[model samples]
Target: MRHLKYFCILFVITIVFISGCGNSAKTSKQHEGKIQITTTIGMIKDIVNEVGGEHVAVVGLMKSGVDPHLYKASQGDIQKLEKANIIFYNGLHLEGKMIDIFKKMAKKKTTIAVSKDISEDQLRGWDDGTEGHDPHIWFNVKHWITATKTVRDELIKYDPDHKEDYQTNADAYIKKLEELDQYAEDKIASIPEQTRVLVTAHDAFGYFGDRYGIEVMGLQGISTASEYGSKDVSELRDFLVANKIKAVFMESSVPKKAINAVVEGAKKKGHNVKIGGELFSDAMGEEGTPEGTYIGMVRHNVDTIVDALK
Candidate 1:
């Protein structure tokens, strides 16, 4: 019986070891001859897919409706980062929680920040005397164009053999981005200047407002991690009532309760404020949807804001 028990243990150990090896081999084969890219957000993932084209396999750690400000990397994410040939992220403390992990990965892998190329002159400062520029650079289509070029340059540097393909793809993508930028500018201009105020749950649209010629207000600060109280709500409520702001937008990644509170506060004060629509702030829409892609999301936001505000 003792011999039988020992034999059974050995058999199980052998089976487990063989299975583990097989899985590892399969994982390795999955990225064979392809640049395995792990990106922090869907925006960066879209840029990689556009620039890398058929040569790279890209995976995004944060999907649609994910708030990157508060996102923490999991053990699975760590493994994904480990397996990646290159990693792309939005720096400027956008992925605040994962900054340390990114530093560790930079020592071993090609970890690139797409926002690194954007100059400080183009970035917006916080209104609350806080340090750090706003990290939601994609809201401004022109700023996103800069990010696209950064991805293109990095991919070409890493995979020089595919430099021509990367450059061609980037040219096509930038053309589309330029068109999107024009569309946003035109649509925003149609709204009356006073009625062009964009109020949302958070201050994610400072860059958007600056680029598109609209005023922006938020109940919370730049990062959703910041807290807001009744005093903040009352102040915003008073402003909305005073300005007669027609709509307050909600972010897909942020909770609706805060905006709802603002809207309700306005109603109590005899100013009717509507929840304009949910905008893709920190994240994009679902995959395969029109808003899933970066250009699509921008168009959707422009149309939605125009329809509601104008």
Candidate 2:
């Protein structure tokens, strides 16, 4: 059934691509006016907006609080991708369901995975021996610096006329990311070392934990597509009680049910565990809020975790 759905989507994309050929002149004009970029997640959207600035117009397929693991492309999204001058995604199977769509679109357009350039040493593998590296690179500000550079170079490659602007914008953004990295280090250091364990909805913060020196655990696996049975929950509860963990976090993009169950189980076991706060994991906060941007989102998470754990 899933295979058939993907096939149907590809068929629609093929028909749209064939029909769109006649509008090449108009498409060229639009591309000439402003680079139309379609990104998969809010983090990439924010990076493009910061680096591309006024030279590019970006549309993110997934909105705030929308989990990319389960996100399916809509007809409107296909239109956006069809008309885009470039498409940027996290890659490493982050957008699990839309991988085929991205590959199909890449055949004709500039579809770049911003995470592609990160070296193997910098990436963390799944503890369960999952095939791919973790996709939550944005959690580590330094890795996001790499992604920003990738976005800058790609934008320059596609739109060389704005090369200087892209370079300048990227340099500035990278500097900010550097400062954000230091801030995270300092803030995370404030939490007592023994209580520095970060428990969340899923394993989206492995990079974050590695970068900031925190022990991270999640109720669900790396991908939300993977399920967590009662055994997983009970085990997590035991770990929390054993450590006297004060809080576990809920992700903005993930349901609270699993974390809630853990909390209830901990309570029944006579260990109180509060929901630390909602962290922006796969998705970010709303557009206008501070948590909406990549830097802001990281700062918010660091502050929330420090405040709760300290």
Candidate 3:
């Protein structure tokens, strides 16, 4: 009887140990199945969600309205990148400061620069007179659709198990982006030709202006990190006065003081130029807001520009 009791106790112990081991194995498999994805900006994260569906856990390094040109990644961001199965970023120096770290990660992980597929000829002018593409390709809905496709293809390459789902989601998203492009074109057409001039704190909207036939003037160059000079202000003020432009715009990521200076200088020249609206240049709106999504961001900008310019 004593021996039987001792054997029963050992059997129970063995069963508990096996059960714990099984549970641990199950948890490990669950963690392994989870595909961790990291994106440079919130916009790319949004696209990744569209293609990845429920299969991925996605994180964005830069928050909404954060200037990518001057972004400094935190230690947590590096950890996220290291654990990520796949990483995506808007290339063409959009994340100018984060470029070095991203390049290093590319050596180990599946790092994809989505905007690398954009053609050189389609890009806008450079200070050096070369085809330096604007990194804000998200502004143009058509270009973004192309980017979405690129993202889908890359995601499919990494995760072939969900290729059909990725393709389906990408196609649906592209249709929505197409509708957004048409909406932008219609709204921008309502603005008179002369008033279509978009002057802002920086030249981030070069792609936007080119796409919609609007002329853009900026106090600073493509990079918001670059300092704005008095000469830039003087030249912009003269242009506003000479053109009789009624509105100048401010960017969400750029400091308002520079734009305010333009407004003040224009007023001194007897030109009544008002701030058109806060445009989403370098970044989109807050995460939960309507302007957070790429389509919503472009819509909000077009609506703002049309209301101010028309």
Lowest summed lDDT over 10 consecutive residues: which window, candidate 3?
125-134
- The TM-score that candidate 2 achieves is 0.89
- For 37-142, candidate 3 gives per-residue lDDT tens digits of 9998888998998878878878888887789989988999999899899999998888888889988999999999988788877766555355555687877777
Question: Clash totals for all models, in order?
Answer: 0, 0, 0
Best by TM-score: 1
**Looking at model 2, which ten-residue stretch has the lowest summed lDDT?**
22-31
Kindly report which residue stretches of model 1 are placed more than 4 angstroms away from their true locations once superposed. 1-30
- In candidate 2, which residue ranges exceed 4 Å CA deviation? 1-32
**Candidate 1, 252: how far from true, in Å?**
0.4
- Tens digits of per-residue lDDT, candidate 1, 4-114, equal 999999999999999999999997787689999999989899999998988998989998999999999999999999999999999988898999999999999999998
**lDDT tens digits by residue: candidate 2, 82-180:** 999999999988898999999899999999999989998898886568668888889989899999999999999999999999999999999999999
- CA shift of 263, model 3, Å: 0.4
TM-score of each: 0.91, 0.89, 0.88
